[model samples]
Target: MSPQKWDENHPARILLLKEMNEGRIPLDSNEMGPAEVYYKYHSTVEFQVEGMEYNSTFTSRLRRLREQIRRDQGKPEKATKTKTARKKKDVSLTWNENHPARILLYKEIAEGRIPLDEKEMGPAEVWCTYHDTLEFQMDGVEFNDNFATRLSSLRAIVKRDQGRAANDRKALEKAMKNHPVQELNHRGEPQWNGSLAQALLQQDMAEGKHETMRPSELWEARPEYKEAFSRKDDFRWKIRQEIRTKKYLYTLEYRAEEKLRKNLKKEGIVLPDQDEDLDGVMDLEEMEDT
Candidate 1:
């Protein structure tokens, strides 16, 4: 691990933005894989962030790194959702960036052109504002309000995932507690804490319930093992499915918490204990401060 060598205009991040703009890297979870960008491009900046590897460093901090670059330049955080404050601090998205409509929407909101509670605005409105409703392509995809919405969702997921992974422990703990299967060894014998719990669970799913089993007898066990046996040749898919499920559940919980906070705020009840990031994104590190 080394200290971060990044400032507002670090070449590492500049290269990343270049890669992002060039379509070499994608924002969708569906596109995650062993990309050339991960190996070739990521190496250029892997030394900047401490302990983060070339493969994971960028995807893990997709949104935050950009925001960090902005902050390092002495720019203010994102604009306020509050109409009154928004007037004082006109926020903006990068005009030359891929997601220009999002900036336009925020600017519109800041200018009081749209109500805070306004229903979803159409993508056509974005096209109309920018190009007289002319259809266009951006990053090889049709540019419309739907793309804007997807951009927001992807950004949200990136931000949420980039936050401390520990913040998601509640969901993991719930799974471990509520799971019908208990810890078991490869042989199916029960093992206590300090063992490889995940491997044990996979084995349990493979063999079903068994009071007594041995690692040597694994092949002779039942064929209906749901976890390990079913996905024997598809370990990658299993891991991806588990990761996606975990992220989805964690995101649902985060959204619910956001809703509760908003409702409480209307009643003049600010939960000081749950101060989100200045940008209104809840970084797990920030959440744990209180």
Candidate 2:
């Protein structure tokens, strides 16, 4: 019901005021606040039938009355200017409902899908969890940034708002840094053994990491490969040995197709005619083994 519909002595006003006084309700009496609880009650069947506004105008009346009562009793101001200024700065840092990222994050927090207190969660872990969620759009808001960037910004702002400690932030940064690897064995490479180095090389090959050059030329130009192999003769022997294997040949083909597909995709080209053939040829199971 509208504030005009009720007297100060009305039971609705009395009960609402009681709830507010007991700290059982939010006095979200401002236009900017969500006032979720107020709206929940205002949307009751009786009030709905009366065509009450969901704009929270009723709470403004309660707010003014509460202030008047406090002033009459000679109560001091609850918030200091410094505190108010800090709050204003925090509000500016926070994303509003209009931000596409906020639309998803707010929904997730409200539904308990994601933790409301970001300070308790590690930033990287929270970021990982929000990756897929950030990809979704709510209420038709368009997101210009990619999912990773959006989640990164959202998480940082949340941590800032919660006053995440400097040491805790340093801990988060330490966790995000790449951990050092231990070379327990020295089969060939000083930094990495033959098995680990070969695995890394094969994975890179599968991902089309190298430019369009012969394996020998790549081995000569890339220092990592020289470190991994230790000798050009050994590299040559290994390539000749691996090329006989079915998995090796499949990996080469996969890298070639991946390179072509990526280049074509950048130009907005699709090979519709060969998509079925490509799908058939790109055996994921074999690629996984490679």
Candidate 3:
């Protein structure tokens, strides 16, 4: 009947009345109650709104908001399901035997892809220890000579777990591949024919010279020879020989010797017979005669 001012609360009602005057309202609502009028006007307001794109966009946004709420509530359930699936996968792939590669193989078996015999898996503790050992050796901060041996052992264990013949020979070969072949003489003693021998000979010659010369005369006449003679024991033929030979000896023996020395000193025992009588120890004449 009259134009209305734009009131935010009654915009929809105002729009409904305008549409009705324009003959666009879906139904005649003059007979409706106040509450019924509001409902009917609201429905007509929505219907009269132009553009399908705007309506579709609003519907889509509402749907997205509902999905976000559902996802938030379902997070724990989804996470639990995921964790269970991972655990099942791990169980299927684990190895059972006490092989060197048992830990790695067990992991593979847990995946269910590698079929392993139930009897083959050793004690769980042993498997765990072996796994830890391999991990330590492979990932240690400092590399050691024992790494090759440990790796070889791991490969052998893996082969055993798989029911395959252990390739120890190949493993050993591979392990030793990177190690330098120690240069040794005919008697398996390290070669000492370089500067070591020269240093020894020079000292011996200087010592022989010093035996016949006075200290003052020696110092004044040949200062260099005096200096060399002073270092005689430090560059002795016997000590050089020991160094060359000891290089090829078992490392455990050297460690044991050091430990013994340390323990002896700790117990206040002086190490007896520190020096060897070379002439008595090695009878060169007898060897020559023989």
Report the lDDT tens digits of candidate 1 across residue range 1-290.
Answer: 55566555556667776665566654332233223234344445433456434333454565565455556557565553456434422532223323334444444554546333324544455444544110121122346565566445544544455454566787788887888556565656444334453455455644542224443243235332343333343433444343444455565567666654444333222333454433434455634542
| Per-residue accuracy of model 2 over 7-94 as CA lDDT, tens digit each | 6655556666666666565433321222334444554444443424433365465576567556765765556445644454344222
RMSD from true fold, candidate 3:
32.9
The TM-score-based order of candidates, best leading, equals: 2, 1, 3
TM-score of decoy 1: 0.20
Each candidate: how many clashes? 5, 0, 17
Candidate 2 TM-score to native: 0.27
Worst 10 residues of 2 by lDDT: 133-142
Return the TM-score for each candidate structure: 0.20, 0.27, 0.15
Across residues 1-290, which tens digit of lDDT does each residue of candidate 3 receive?
A: 34333243345434544544454532322222122223334344443443312222433433343344446545322323355334533442221232224344445554533334434543342334443322222112123344334334544555575553346666767877976455664545444445344454446444664446443443445444334334444334444344334333434344444454443332222233354333323233533433
**Candidate 2 vs candidate 3: which has greater TM-score?**
2
On lDDT, the stronger of 2 and 3 is 2
